[model samples]
Target: MPRQPASFLPIADALRTRIRAGDWPVGERLPSRAHLAAEYDVSPMTMQRAVERLIIEGLLEGRAGSGTYVRTPRERLRMVRSRHRERRGGSPFRSDMAEQGKRGTWESHSQARVPAPDGIAHRLAIQPGDHCVRTAYEFLADGMPVQLSTSWEPMAITDGTPIVLPELGPLAGMGVVERMRTIGVVIDTAVEVPRPGRATQEEANMLGISVGDLLMRIERTYYDADGRPVETADITVPDVRWEIAYEIGIEQPE
Candidate 1:
């Protein structure tokens, strides 16, 4: 193994970019650590740090009997949701994004507008056939995928807003709570439900793991001041690299 003198973050970021760009397509096996170490001209430990960072972000998963694999959008989002639930009274998105951006050097990994899937349609509380704007992004922090997010907004509402043309100009931030503000829908509260299960093929493909791996599923719905369901987000997090801690506030007894 060689030392780059440069930090491992850049190496990790570049590797992640390759994956996001289809250099390492979904379900594709990556090279061994020794190979990666040689390719990046870094020590094994430094390469390990880069891999660990992505693992912590729920983008990659390693198995006792198998190698690492790319995680799915669902698993990545679940990690973000779990962390958001744990941290109270602040902007969870900003905190998470800032940390993640620092890792991958804040480069855009992937973006696309696709039709919402069935599960997403149900969560958004829209009709089965309704169309929505779906955007998926792989964000890296310190050169790894720390966050994988997919956002869906009803075309009916967003079509009228500047968000309709995201590539043309700057719109709202990635978070639904923040994005809603652009449409005069302020999110004052969020309710979350958490479920646990084995990872599916789709999840395994994205997170770079095998099916049946442990995963945490989180469903979050945002509400406006008038109690309207403004947005719903579903997230799946791999159990290996990510964990959420919660603190509850208690009132003093009289």
Candidate 2:
């Protein structure tokens, strides 16, 4: 058997070492692929893959026919902290928009008995195949789509509420928390879990973006006084429109 080419790691590592050692200063062009291949004693195809890996890692950028250059180290990510709890109000989506002087509206699509999705079922403490009243809505801020949400409530509890009514005005003026309060269920705390996910084809079309563009998936769950779960909502917001915040509480030494 003969030794093959096109493995990228060792080549990438060598280049990474040079860049980290300040051999290639910020905004400097690295040697061309043909040049790197000659220097590293590798074939062009193998050298190309190694360069591609660096580009994907944000350590390098390729300019068409111009050449590859070392990218200035840019912050990969940032977190915003707001100390005043008052600034962080209820309705994480709408409240933030309102704070920034953005008026928004919600258009309810429908509310009906539908089986919960696997994740929603687990959060709501319901069986995977169990029935639940699902409410879908589109949220708009300043006439622009901001978020799309679908909420699930176990049928046993919502069957007595007006959740299934045909009329499609806001389910309750005071929002989900208030509506549940009407049923003697008071939610004291809620948590939102967000993750990076690719927008579905339909979502990309509706949101005017390329299919599989980056998006944020938020799953919010509200818990009642007895520590029982009351509501679970899945929200999708465009990456440009929403920001996330977290509060960490410390426990005193026992």
The best candidate by TM-score is: 2
- Give the CA lDDT, 0 to 100, for residue 87 in model 1: 39
Per-residue lDDT over 145-178 for candidate 1, one digit per residue giving the tens place of the 0 to 100 score: 4434555666765666765533334643345555
Name the weakest run of 10 consecutive residues (lDDT summed) in model 1: 103-112
- The positional error of residue 97 in candidate 1, measured at the CA in angstroms, is 5.7
Q: Which candidate should be chosen as best, given lDDT against the real structure?
A: 2
- For each of the candidates, the C-alpha root-mean-square deviation to the true structure, in angstroms, is 13.7, 8.1
Instruction: Determine which window of 10 residues in candidate 2 has minimal summed lDDT.
Output: 77-86
lDDT of each: 0.61, 0.71
Model 2 C-alpha lDDT per residue in residues 59-143, reported as the tens digit of each score: 8889998999999653332222222332343344466557657775677655567877787788988888788777777777787
Each candidate structure's TM-score, on Cα atoms with residue i matched to residue i, is: 0.54, 0.59
